[model samples]
Target: MNTLTDDIDAHALEAAWGELDRVARLRPIHDEDSYDHAVALMNRVLDVMGDNEQHPLAGLLELLATLVGNYEQKHYSLI
Candidate 1:
């Protein structure tokens, strides 16, 4: 069992899902501050994903990315 606070060793997002699941939903990334947190964590994950070309985590990352993007788009529109 891996806790999110534990050092993330696996670079693949899918491989990280079980660990991510442990913490992902616990942190609410809805508002600017929360989203910033999410972005920072996600960017770290992305750094680990560098130049892999293929990773099991890609799909899950894509899903999370889209979710975050949509949330930002909907909530932060100046219009």
Candidate 2:
């Protein structure tokens, strides 16, 4: 069972979440514009994360990557 949520501080989480939301507006990748937006957001996260896999926004970076990847697979998949 995942205990990650068991010890979270709600107030701190809210503030941090708000900050992230202010920086990047993430959503499901769809058309070219959405795909470009996701890529740009991913780059923004990278500016903060660098190569550290344990950074605070690592999960957010991963999520952005997944969104971009899904869109790429749908549109640019190599058969």
Candidate 3:
């Protein structure tokens, strides 16, 4: 398990960041269309990443999912 005290692997960190940038552009969910796009992106990531907590992309997926949920809660009534 990785911890804060663990020594950072610079090359691996750089590759991870690159993957994150490629997968998630990290755009603001400002409108319905943008929110929809975010939802789709999140779904794609979830399909690949699943609920695996140890996966490197898990954090990015969670962040996108949270953004989607927040936008939906604020803009639309939940059924």
Candidate 4:
């Protein structure tokens, strides 16, 4: 099966660097839709985990996840 963490090469990762950068810099995802999009993107990274080949995209995903998680924690923290 195609995985995000499989067969990843520097060149392939470099190719995706721009998109990863954009995602990393994404902000103001205040609505559920935007949050959902981030989640979806994260899930997509997980689903493709084996094929990412150490793709920097994964790092972007992690950063985005952190951002989303931080927002959620502040806005929807449990009492």
Candidate 5:
């Protein structure tokens, strides 16, 4: 099977990630549904992880926050 060390290339990497993405609870926010999902996930992560930077999921929390922030800035901006 094609793998990362096989010189598989970017297309292979994307294809592998796409399979996971299909079942992923969190992904890039493209619309309201995705936006809502990301927000809910972030909230849950916040509740469980809080502001603990050393927590294993802190990076995930940060990424989810960034996704939500970017979406809001694009869709809900007053400017």
Candidate 6:
């Protein structure tokens, strides 16, 4: 079983970096257009992963959701 303190090997770290780079290439949501794109990406991720907390893409989905939420909160008035 894996624990939080377990160190990730170099190969795993490299793979993680690769994934981050690929995702970063998708440009984060900064304006209306990017916001729409981000929403689409988030929807795709959700469709694949659903609400499974143990899914590999869960962290990425959560990060995208947070980015979308932050952009919306800043650009639109909340009720």
How does model 4 score by TM-score? 0.55
Where does the lowest 10-residue lDDT sum fall in candidate 5? 19-28
lDDT scores of the candidates, listed in order: 0.68, 0.86, 0.83, 0.74, 0.84, 0.83
Name the candidate that leads on TM-score: 2
Q: What TM-score do all the candidates reach, one by one?
A: 0.55, 0.70, 0.64, 0.55, 0.68, 0.66
Show where candidate 6 strays beyond 4 Å: 1-24
Best by lDDT: 2
Better-scoring candidate (lDDT), 4 or 6: 6
Pull out the clashing pairs in model 3: none
**Cα TM-score of candidate 5:** 0.68
Clashing pairs in 2: none
Which one wins by TM-score: 1 or 6? 6
Residue 23 error, candidate 2, Å: 3.3
For model 3, state the Cα shift of residue 27 in Å. Answer: 1.4
lDDT string for model 4 (1-79, tens) is: 9887677887877867767567643555788887888787777777767676588677766777797898799789899
lDDT of 5 by residue, 1-79 (tens): 8776888577988987888578556678999999988988888888888768799888888899899999999999998
Lowest-scoring 10 consecutive residues by lDDT in candidate 3?
19-28
Clashing pairs in 6: none
Q: Which is the winner by lDDT between candidate 1 and candidate 2?
A: 2
lDDT by residue for model 1 over 1-79, one digit each (tens)? Answer: 7789576565675666667677665254668877776777667657778767477656656766776788788898888
Q: Is candidate 2 or candidate 3 better by lDDT?
A: 2
Q: Which stretches of candidate 2 lie over 4 Å from their true place?
A: 1-22
Query: lDDT tens digits, residues 1-79, model 6?
Result: 7876576587888898889679654566777888998899889889989768799988878889999998888888667
Worst 10 residues of 4 by lDDT: 20-29
